[model samples]
Target chain A: MSYKDKKVITIGVVRDLTGLSERQIRYYEERKLIFPERTPGGSRKYSFADVELLVEIANKIEDGVQTHEIRKEMLRAQKKQNQEDVRRKMIQGQLNAQFGLRKGPTS
Target chain B: MSYKDKKVITIGVVRDLTGLSERQIRYYEERKLIFPERTPGGSRKYSFADVELLVEIANKIEDGVQTHEIRKEMLRAQKKQNQEDVRRKMIQGQLNAQFGLRKGPTS
Candidate 1:
């Protein structure tokens, strides 16, 4: 796991970082907008990435965007990104094949 | 917009391309999973990108993933990807500054 993926930050820290209330954070979690890991004692532990996502979610909500619409837009953007990645990799693979490289393609 | 974003394909063509029933495609639209443009005569039109997205949505549904969960996962993945892109651009900017480049960093 990367440093941002480590779930070591508490909800209070996230609340301070994102300027969102505790109840609001919990509500986002209930709506499946954010997923924080659960501690052994059942406390919530959020990652750095989750904090950034919460800030983004809050910004969209403040701009009058619904949570569901935000989710859908994200999905569509991700689908486009995945397609781009696949296309890039395919081109890289063909380039490598043409250059007689076994595996790695030169950056 | 790119070629993939042009909403020129009809639902029937998308059905032929994706093997999805018309009703199923319309249902996904109703659920706000896909957004197709409309013609002056009120015909639904989809883009090449939308067709690809529909196929991806179908695969996730067939794999027993709930639509909401799939959307949430996509949002999180997209958030991570945006962060990566920002980091990459920042590094590129720093490299350009070091090289005294005024604009357009070389790829």
Candidate 2:
């Protein structure tokens, strides 16, 4: 899955979309939850994906999960998902190697 | 989607499993994060799901999401998920009504 997005949103836009205070947003960054881009002047510039992540983080916070804990779980879950992808790719590669598979070729 | 579970664990187990202090756990409950079942004497009895939720909450906290914000976001997310579920069920019911769907029936 691509984490990149085209639109670059400001912190204010994130506040509007996720209903989070600027302080909270910055604090979340301090905690390392979501990392938006930085302008040359050191202003925060968020992507669409960052917006979604803020929303998700807000949801988890509302659910009574602690700050540090959320980070750990998300990272763990992400790692697990990445591993699953790698595993699937490895299997696919093996299958192709054995069967002499090629793109757009089915017989 | 079943929130119910067997094996009711005590606070001690939750603490051990989640690496959360008792005070933090109780504080999380007061903040309305995880609501385990209460015994007649008012002791907490948690299910596996509750334990998992606590773990998740811890992860989020580690990730830098704030407390109240997390609660708000989680609630919003849950409401959205519930709405999606209702929408799906409504669609499925309509389709079944129109097509006379039956259990274990396939052509």
DockQ of each: 0.01, 0.01
TM-score of 2: 0.45
CAPRI tier for the interface of model 1:
incorrect
**lDDT of candidate 1 at residue B74, scale 0 to 100:** 73
- Per-residue error at B107 for model 1, in Å? 30
Model 2 stretches astray by more than 4 angstroms: A1-107, B1-4, B101-107
Q: How close is chain B to the truth by TM-score, in each candidate?
A: 0.73, 0.82
Candidate 1 residue runs with Cα over 4 Å from true position: A103-107, B1-107
Residues B24-107 of candidate 2 have per-residue lDDT tens digits of 889988998878776556767666677778888888899998778779988999999999999999998999888966888578
Residue-level lDDT of model 1, residues A1-107, one tens digit each, is 75466565567657766889999999888877888887666778776678889999999999999888888887898899999999999998898789855756767
- Clashing pairs for predicted structure model 1, backbone only: none
RMSD of 1: 23.2
Native contacts present in each candidate (fraction):
0.00, 0.00
Where does the lowest 10-residue lDDT sum fall in candidate 2 chain B?
A: B1-10
